[model samples]
Target: MTEHATAVAALTPAIADGPQTIKVIISGGFAAVYRDMLPEFERSTGISVETGSGASEGAGPKTIRHQLANGTKADVVILSREGLHKLNEDGRIRAGSEAGLATAPLAAAVRTGSRKPDIGNDVALRKALIDAGQVVAPSSTSGQYVRDKVFPRLNLPDTVRLTLEARGTEAAEALRAGKANLSIGPTSELVQESGIEVVGLLPPDLQLVQTFTAAIVSDAQAPEAAKRLIDFLSLDSDILLAAIKRAGMERPRG
Candidate 1:
């Protein structure tokens, strides 16, 4: 049998055994592809999905780590490797149940119809940041990289503004609302939003290709169904992975 079929067959029993719904809390890093492929997973396994959004890496209440600690119900949690590592360290993820989902590089975007800046090189990217009065970013892994690492390298003046939002899509919204001149986050999240124009990946030296991962939460209510969900996402199915690539993310690299 084909790999995909074999994977699906393993989960068929769960559908008959009892409840078939699995709760998932995911960050935007993997949300694009997940949303794209979810219907097929449900069709194959007869499992229903209930999903919500969270941030992958941040101290805020929106982070998966924080929510899980606060008694959020999630059979599966999708987030950055950094956040997963933290969950793992804290024993929040079920041991040996993690699967890598996809990777996406940080990118810049401006409100559609705005002047696009040249950020192809380090110097040009620096100037672009300065030229734009304020740059908006999310509180995810990519934003932390910019706030913690990239800005220090540029050493721009205090006059440059930085507006941070709780999520990547919100950062895009900030740009669309004229709250900032540019937004930065995973390419997969912002590139698909209307009224947003992606400038491109950050200059090579400053680029971060964040790995998004999926794992069963330790307190998952539907462990078997959650495993099946992870299988469908990571089985390397061309139809889904191709859609992921077309949506501005790369297949996850081990």
Candidate 2:
């Protein structure tokens, strides 16, 4: 068994009587990895996890902020650090319970079989945008970053034809449907769709890395189970690291 599984197995017996269910509301940024790890957690802890999705950015009603505002019964939440901080301030999350999970960089993707465009440098990226017919971007963290920061920096705010989608997957879907020639969002989101070929991460100079974090909900119905889930995921094991990498994220540094 993997070291992470071994560790979880060793710890499972101690929480034999803990809550049997954990409900988590997580942003799309880390959804793939969290889902990938759920079965292992259930096997080790005997606790079932129910997950819900939310966008990491935007003030839309479906965003995590709105879910917490409407009193979603979340035992745990995983979202961008900024969003977590807002929850902490609003007394939605337990203070001091936050833990950094992974960092995902922005990436560019094209429909499968499309000629990969060069985005190796600022100049090439600018040219790629200028030459593309339609560009799709999520109206979330990475998209906001590109819209508010990168576009102005590139001095092509009005040059590129941009289509903004409510979520990352939508942006990828637009690319797959031929609605857009290029799509940009978190690498994790881009990698989740099968019909698109991820060109690569944006050039380092233009890259925006978003850090995802997890925390126990302040009024969680299963606080102990939630804390245990956080602890299990925070364990720096090879299995966890590999899963993060496969989900297009990197382990955060100390």
Candidate 3:
């Protein structure tokens, strides 16, 4: 039997007779891989996945934590590890269900046809950011990383513009509109924008290898199914790696 077939067989003891769907609330980080792999998961396990999108971290109702607090129903959540930590702090996630899915390196982008920023080294990236004048980043973990670490380490003066976008799409939109000269976010998110072209990942010193995690909600409607879904995502295999690569992500590093 194939590896997928064996895993499905092992996971099937809990599956019921009829149609079953598990509602999932996920931030942008894991959505691409999840969306790409969901159909196969469903086909193998006879489980339907209902997905919802939100930022992993931010100050508004659009964040996963905010939605969960405001009574957004979900069995599972997929979001940045930082956001998952918050959910755990809030006592919203089931104990010990957290699983790391994949990690993506922070990337930089410029408007289509614009000059690609020099990101060959830490010094080059710092100079690029300074020369660009303004940078737009999503108001999620990646944005927070920029605010707390990347910007400060580079000593970008307050005069250099910085804006927190609500989502990667918004950050990319800002570049497309020429409102900003650069954007920094996960490669997965940046690749989705058609009006922008990625320059390259941030220099190694400034990179944020954001890990996307999956966990069952504390009040999940289908806890077993949630566990199964998380397992499907977390377990490494040829197919899973292929899906992650397709989404511009990779297996989480130790």
Error of 1 at 86 (Å): 1.3
For model 2, which pairs clash?
none
Global lDDT for candidate 2?
0.84
Global lDDT scores for all candidate models? 0.85, 0.84, 0.87
lDDT of 2 by residue, 135-247 (tens): 89988777888888888888884658888788887888889899899998889888888999988888998899999999998889888788788888888888788889998
Positional deviation of 168 in candidate 2, in angstroms? 1.1
- Listed in order, each prediction's TM-score against the native is 0.94, 0.93, 0.93
In order of lDDT, best first, we have 3, 1, 2
lDDT of 1 at 90: 82
TM-score of decoy 2 = 0.93
Quick one: RMSD of model 3?
1.9
Clashing pairs counted in every model? 0, 0, 0
Tens-digit per-residue lDDT, 1-254, candidate 1: 44564666765455557548899999988887888888777776678999988998788798888899898899999999998999999889999998887888888998899899999988988899999979999987888888888888989788778877888878888899998998888898886789999998898999999889999999898898898888788876667768788778887654
* TM-score ranking, high to low: 1, 2, 3
